[model samples]
Target: MNKILEASLKGEVLVIKTEGYLNKDLGQDIQDAAQEHIANGINHVLIDLEQSNIVNSIGASIIIELIEQLQETDGTLAFCNLAPIIEKTFKIMGLTKYCSCYSNENDAIEAMS
Candidate 1:
């Protein structure tokens, strides 16, 4: 299930939902999905990881790259439905400083909006 489950715009925010492991491929897919929106000035992004429970270093690195990409647009990246371990890992990787993690998509959307 290394794929994007869904991608749509909610207001001005681009919400990308992913499934399976957050590996390089899936990470790239997420980046690609958001790139167009970011380019068009939809800077706020919410990644719903309710189905993605594991991530490798490369995946995390790509997310870091995405954060950099968003910064160029003065945009932000947020995550929702992160597993406890995934949230801890992002914190340890210092990713939380660049982005935010919410318990669910609604919370993330509200906060981002």
Candidate 2:
């Protein structure tokens, strides 16, 4: 099942770890979680998608929305541990132009922080 495994702050960045398919529902869940942190003045978001290997178009669009939302506050969005296909999809969707993809959580956190 699609679900957000965890949402927590790692330093000033909000880290959201997800599992299963990244469809509309899970994307919305991720947006909601990030929204809360954004409201509280957190600008950097790191999504750990090690367990989520699938993403639909709707999910990608929702992430586009999330990127816009973060931009409104001068925040940034990032991803880590993405599957090869997912990374390629994001690149094709132009997501890589806005956010970055890291090989692991530590690399992402270190870069974002």
Q: Which portions of model 2 miss their true places by more than 4 Å?
A: none
| Alpha-carbon lDDT, every model | 0.92, 0.95
RMSD of each: 0.7, 0.6
TM-score: which candidate is best? 2
Per-residue lDDT over 1-113 for candidate 2, one digit per residue giving the tens place of the 0 to 100 score: 99999999999999999999999999999999998889899999999999999999899899999999899988899999999999999999999999999999999999999
Candidate 1 wrongly placed segments (more than 4 Å): none
TM-score, candidate 2, is 0.98
Cα lDDT tens digits for candidate 1, 13-81? 899999999999999999999988887889999999999999988998999989998898789999999
Which residue pairs show backbone clashes in model 1? none
lDDT of model 2 at position 80: 96
Please give the distance, in angstroms, between residue 7's alpha carbon in candidate 1 and its true position after superposition: 1.0
